[model samples]
Target chain A: MLAQGLTITISVLIASAFFGYLFAFIAGLCRLSKNVILRKFTGFYVEIFRGTSLIVQLFWLYYAVPMLFGIELGSNWWVGVIAIALNYGAYMSEIVRGSILAVAKGQTEAATALNMSRFQRMRLVIFPQAVRMMLPEFGNYLIQMLKATSLVSLIGMHDILYYGDILRSSNLSQAPTVYLLVLVFYFILALPLIFLTRKMEDISKKGVASQ
Target chain B: MIEPIVTFNDVHKSFGDVKVLKGIDLDIKPAEKVAIIGPSGSGKTTIIRMLMTLEQPTSGDIIVDGKNLWKMEKKGSMVDANEKHLRNVRGDIGMVFQHFNLFPHMTILENCMTAPIHVKNEDKSTAKQRSIEMLEKVGLGDKLDNYPSQLSGGQKQRVAMARALVMRPKVMLFDEVTSALDPELVGEVLEVIRDIAKEGEMAMILVTHEMDFALDVADKVLFLDEGVIAEQGTASEVIEHSTNERLQSFLHRFRS
Candidate 1:
C-alpha cells in the first residue's frame, strides 16, 4: 500500500512539473509579446494564480470548479496536478521572462548586425544563453514544488502522506515511527534532485567562466 | 567618379530630449576606408550604429547601394521600413562591436558558421569550409572548437571578426573594436583589422581613438564634434595639417 502511494505521488509530481514548464514558457513568451491583448491576458493569468493560496486553488479546482462549470476533471489526481501546475507555472514564468531579459544587450545587437530576424535571434542566440541562466532558479522552484505535492493527499489522491496518515491512525503507538518513515521517504526522493541541481549549476558556471 | 556605396543625407538622431547627432551628411564609396575620430559623446559610434540598423535615424535618409535603409516604398509612398525591410537592406553590412560580442554557448567555428547557415541557407559542409577559411585568415585556425569563455580577449575579438567576415559583407563597420582589450592585447586585434583593410575588397568605416591606426588604414578621416562633422579630408591632411583650434585641442590630448 505504501509503495502504491509512493508510485502515485511520483507520477503526479512528474506530470505537474512537465505541464508546469510548458505553461511557463508559453505564458512567459506571451508576456513579452508585442500584442497588447496577449500581454494583458497572460498578465491576468499570472496574477490570478500567484495571488491565491495554493491549497485554496487545489480545493476550488477539485470541488468548487465541477459544480460551477458542470464539467468533470475525471480523476482527483488530475485536479490536484492542474491546480498545482497552474499556480507554480505562474511563478516560474516570471523566472523565464527575467532570465531572457537578462541576456546582455550586446548579444542582441550582434544578432541584429548579422541580419537575423527576431525569431531567429531569440531561438538561436537569446534562448540558448537564457536557458543556462534559468537553471539554478528553476532548481529551487523544483524542490519547493516537490514539497507542495504533499497537499494532494488532503484531496484523497493516496499520496505518501495519505498512507502515512492511515498507518498512524490504526497503530497510534507507531505514529512516531510512521511519521519518521514518511520524512525519510521525502528526503530520499529529494536527494537525486539536489544532486542534479548541483550538477547543472556546475555546468552553467563552466559555460560562463574560463576553462 | 565612383558611385557612393552608402549615403547619409541630413541624418539626425535624438535620445529623448538630448540630440546625439545633428544634421550629418556623409558618403562611403565602395572599397573606401574611412575613420571617424571623436570624443566620447560626439556621436561617432551612433553614426555607424545607424548605418548597421542597430539604431534608427530620427530624421533623414540612409541609402545603401541605392536603396533606402530606414524607409521603404509602400504603394508608391515612402513609409518607415518594417523589420523585414530593414533586415533586407542591412544584409550587405556587418559590424564588430566594442565588446566583441561572440556567442558564449557556441564554439568559435559555430559562431562563424551560424549566420551563414541559418540566414543565407548555406549547406552545412560548405558553411563549415567557409568558416574554417575565415578563421584561418584571422589566424585562429587551431582554436575552432574553443568556446568564447575559453579564449583570451584578443582571440575572442579575432573570432568576432571571423564571424562578421564569413557573411562576405560589402561594408564592414568597426566601432572602437579595441576599446575593451588590454593594452598588450590591442595590438593583435588591430593587426587583424590592418590585414583586412589591406585587401580593400569592401568599404570599411572605423570609429576609433587610434589616430595612428586611422592614418595607416584610412584614406579619408572625419573628425566629429558637437554632433556634427567638424572637419573631413585625407587622413594625413586632417590629422597633421589641420589648423582648426577645436580640432588642434582635441589632437593635443592624443599626442601626449
Candidate 2:
C-alpha cells in the first residue's frame, strides 16, 4: 500500500514539475513579449491560477470543470497533474520573468550593438545568465509543488497521504506507528529533492566562478 | 573625391522639453578621426550615440555609407528603421562604452567571437582564428580564456575594443572609453585605439575627456557647447587656438 502510494506521489511530482516548467517559461516569455494579445492572454492565465486557492483550483478541475464542460477528463490522475502544474506554474512564471529582467540591461545593449538578432541575444546571451538567477527560486517552487501534491488525495487520488489516512483508520489503536512510518516515507522522498537543489546551486555557482 | 562615410544632415535631438542636439550638420570622410569634446551634458556623447543608432534624431537624418540610418525604404515609402533594418545596418558600426560591457559568462575569446559567428554566420574555426588575432592585437591573447571578472579594467576595455574590431566595422565610436579606467591604466587602452586608428580605414568618432590624447589622435576636433558646435577645426586649431568664449571657458575648466 505504501509502495503504491509512493509511486503515485512521485509520478505526480515529476509530471507536474516537467509540465509546470514548460508552462512557466512560455508564460514568462509571453509576459515579456511585445505582442499585446499574447501578453494579455498569459497575464490572464497567471492571474486566474495565482489569485485562487490551490485546493479550490484542484477541486474545480477534478469536479466542477468536467461537469461544466460535460467532458470526461480521463482520470483523477490527469486532473491532479493539471491542477498542480497550472497552480505552481503560475507562481513560477513571476520568478522566471523577474530573473530574465534581472539580467543586466548592459548585457542586452552589448548584444544589440553586436548586431545579434533578438532570438540570438536571448538564447546565447541572456537566458544562460537568467537561468543561473532562476535556479534557486525554481528549487523552492519545486518543493512547494511537492507539498501541494498531497492535495490530490482530496480529489480521490491514491497519493501517500490518502494511503496514510487509510492506514490510520484500519489500525486505530496503533495509529501513531502508521503515521510515524508515513512521516518517514515523506522525509525519505523529500531528502533527495532538497539534496538535488543544493547540488544544482553548487554547479551553477561553480559555472559562473569558472567562467 | 572619396565620398564621406558618415553624414549628419541638420540633426536635432530632444528629450521631451530638454533639447540635447540643435541643428547639427557634419560629414566624416573614411579613415577620418573626429574627436568630440565638451563639458558634461554638452551633447558630446549624444552625437556618437545617434550615429550608432542607439538614439534617434527628433528631426533630420543620419546617413552612413550612403544609406540613411534613421529611415528605411518600406514598400514605396521611407519609414523609421525598425529592429530588423537597424540590425541590417548596425554591422557597419561598432561602439566601445565607458563601462566595458563584456558578457561576463563568456571568456574573452567567446566575447570577441560571438558577434562575428552569430551576425556574420562565420564558422567557428574562422571566428576563433580571427578572435585570437584580434585579442592578440589588443594584448589580451594570453588572457583569451579568462572571464571579464578576472580581467582588470584596462584589460577588459582592451578586450572590448578587440571585440568591436573583430567585426571589421566601417565606423568605430568610442564614448569616453578610458574615462572609467584608472589614470595609470588609461594609456594601454588608448594605445590600442591609436594602433587601430593608424592601421584601419574605419571612420572613428571619439567622445573623450582626455584632451591631450584627443588632440594627439584626432584629425579634427569639434568643441560642443549648449547643444551646438561652438568651435570646430583641426585638432590643434580647436584645442589650442579657439577664441570662442564658451569653448575657452569649457577648456579652462578642464585645464587647471
Maximum-TM-score candidate: 1
Kindly list the per-residue Cα lDDT of model 2 for residues B26-144, writing each as its tens digit: 98999999999998999988898887777889998899998989899989999999988888888899999988888888999999999999899999999999999999988888998
What would the per-residue lDDT of candidate 1 be over residues B169-222, giving only the tens digit for each residue?
999999999999999999999999999999988999999999999999999999
Q: Model 2, which residues run further than 4 Å from truth?
A: A199-211
Assess each prediction's global lDDT (C-alpha) against the native. Answer: 0.92, 0.88
Model 2 earns a TM-score of 0.95
Q: DockQ numbers for every candidate? A: 0.71, 0.55
lDDT tens digits, residues A50-114, model 1?
99999999999988989999998989989888988999999999988987888888889999999
Clashing pairs in 2: none
Superposing every Cα of model 2 onto the true structure, what RMSD results?
2.2
Leading candidate by DockQ: 1
